[model samples]
Target: MNNRYSSNSAGVFTWFRDAAEQGNAYAQFNLALLYKRGKGVQRDDKVAFVWMREAAKQGIAFAQNHLGAMYYNGTGTPPDDSEAVYWFRKSAKQGDASAQQNLGLMYRKGRGVPQSDEMALTWFCRAAEQGVASAQSLLGEAYAQGLGTKRNFPLALAWFRKAALQGDATAQLNLGLMYRRGHGVLQSDTQAVAWYRQAAAQGLAAAQRHLGVAYAEGRGVQVDLERACSWLRRAADQGDVDAQFNMGVMLSNGYGTRKDEAQAFAWYHRAAAAGHMLAQYNLGGMYAHGRGVQRDPAQALVWYRKAADQGAPNAQFNVGVIYANGHGVPKDEARAVAWYRHAAEQGDASAQNNLGVMYANGQGVPQDDAEAVRWYRRAAEQGHPLAQYNLGGMYASGRGVERDPVLSYMWISLAAEAGDETACNNRKLIERKLTREEIGSAQALTRRWRDAHRA
Candidate 1:
């Protein structure tokens, strides 16, 4: 049987070579494929390129498409986006679906051509009409996101279904997302999980991550921590940063397994290395507290600074605390104030209260009672207990604005209600200095404030 197979292959090679030499485009293309795949000849990309070019020159669309792919992938020659685009355009103009898809991708990514969502969508539609699954998926995304056309949920869902039924993993994932978000179909976690399972089984990392989250949160499946951990580990092993971070959370909390602080730290470190902001912050906390590792304030500061630079308010506040206390560095009140300001600007009530204190005490800036009152009021309005108490004091002392026993009583009452023992005492003291009518007004103001800020 082997001898017969070898003989037939040799005969086929001979026949193709002779016809190719006689300028038969199909024969030249077939001979190139044989050389490229080493079916009947040794795989020789350079030699394959020669015959592919010959057939392509004869205006064979398939040959041109194959040659473009070779150029794009640098199979036989140096990778040349421009050359790939040229050949892909030629074949695509001849109604070649694969070439059309390739050209669309090239335009979509701005490789060898200006990025044009419209042009990409145009070619994707053409190839999709020819039943190209990948092109159909791209068309779905374009319609879903209004990339090159108006957002059309129904069209997106239709295209996604077409491609997904053809076994396109990306299409399956998108369809799952559409179902999850109720884009065109009714929101159904069960349907989302079903599609996610299909794509995850196909080794799609994103699908695996989504499936893991679904299982963890009991979105469609029961809350099965073990299953969630298993799926998340798969996605994490594939270097999905979000999955890595979630694994850290699971391990640290003993959700699916024993509380292994070391494993949590390791996972957090991995995601932090990939620039995950929360992971960096968690890593900093681990280092600072000696959780699953030796205490290293310097390392903590390093990770905290990374997360802070990424605009994490908590990390910024931690960085401010580190600078204020001289943890692994010299205490610098100015730097602390600056970091506090960063977090404060992002609506972090704690940071805003701390910044108010800094202004009040003149720790890093010139003492300005009016400025302190301004900062205190900002934080106090956000339901910050300390800021409310401080603002109340400023009113009692008549330092920032005209003294109003009513406002002072109101602010102090708010802080006291939030369980501040000192504010409780202070509220009583301030009440003694006010008339019954003034206290009544203050109480009414507090009620209005509470009603306005409920939630």
Candidate 2:
């Protein structure tokens, strides 16, 4: 389209310049647009500003609006918010929808005048009424968020629908969100997907990502891994961070495509570089395991620490393990305990179990049998088998709580049933110390507990 305009620019410029020199406001505005776009001459904002100012002085509303934009952006002159507002107000008062929308934005952001939602809404309403799709979308946002008036879901829905029908991608995306959340319309995954598809068809990256997730999760559509991967790939190519990370996961797991660890690593690296915590954690694992890249404990530690700093419990646990084992750094029991505690406090069962062992052995903190029992119990109740067996041992030895042969038998029996060989051996030893009746009672207790925790 630009090429078409440039091709005939010389003839068009001569015609417009002749009329503009004869004081034709329309010709002046046309010439200004041509100069601004470099249609016939080298792009010159100064010349564009001169012609636009002349046309605006002759009361051409569009020229007035253009002049305001030039002032607001410092395109041809020093940026002056006050001057921009002056021209916008002049054109807006003359019933120019674009000018009204621009004025509303200036007021909304406190760019040229005092921030005033009420005034912004007033101008937005004017432009929206005049069928300006951008203004309609902004009006919908105002109503939805209670920016200038009471929150009105119905009004917001109505305005969003108006703009969306005019092919406004943002409005379509917002409308989909409203349906998905049941804000102004009935909650309908199908309707949400329909609106999302509309926006996605227009190349909206966010909409594409949402649509891909919906397909992957079988929300509003049949589960279609291939379709999900296709959509996600599109959004990832556009640099959508979430899509990039998800694409990495899909590639790594062979979902909808052949497993390609190298490609997965590339995708993860891209997202991790963009500060995605999960990507950083996953990249750390890949590096540590030598999957798709050479094993590099230093690189693994770098990524793990990055994610751990963002409060990722799994990353914290990995960092603790690394510090404790001297992987890529000197062994530091104190640092290991600190990282373990950070994750354990966040309800990570594995971290709780590890912290229990650390306490029991006096690795970093002084040995405290009772503290070990407490952490072991926390992880055991969450179905950590190792913690359950450790708790059983604690009970059998009376290390933390009162020694109870039956309780030890029951817990050890449960852990043994979960395929822990050590627990099985311990259970046999505990059984030998119990009376027949006590052994039967322990068996019944294990049954009751398992039934209660059945998935």
The backbone clash count of each candidate, in order, is: 0, 0
**308-409, model 2: which lDDT tens digit per residue?**
999999999999999999999999999999999999999999999999999999998999999999999999888788998998999899998999888888
What digit string (tens of lDDT, one per residue) describes model 1 on residues 304-401? 99999999999999999999889999999999999999999999888888888888889888887888898889999999998999999999999888
Q: What is the C-alpha RMSD of each candidate to the true structure, in Å?
A: 2.9, 3.3
TM-score (all chains, Cα) for each model: 0.91, 0.87
Query: Which candidate gets the maximum TM-score versus the true structure?
Result: 1
Which TM-score value belongs to model 2?
0.87
Question: lDDT of all predictions, in order shown?
Answer: 0.94, 0.93
- Deviating ranges (above 4 Å) for candidate 2: 1-8, 18-26, 53-60, 71-95, 99-124, 142-152, 444-448
Q: CA lDDT of 323 in candidate 2?
A: 94
Best candidate according to lDDT: 1
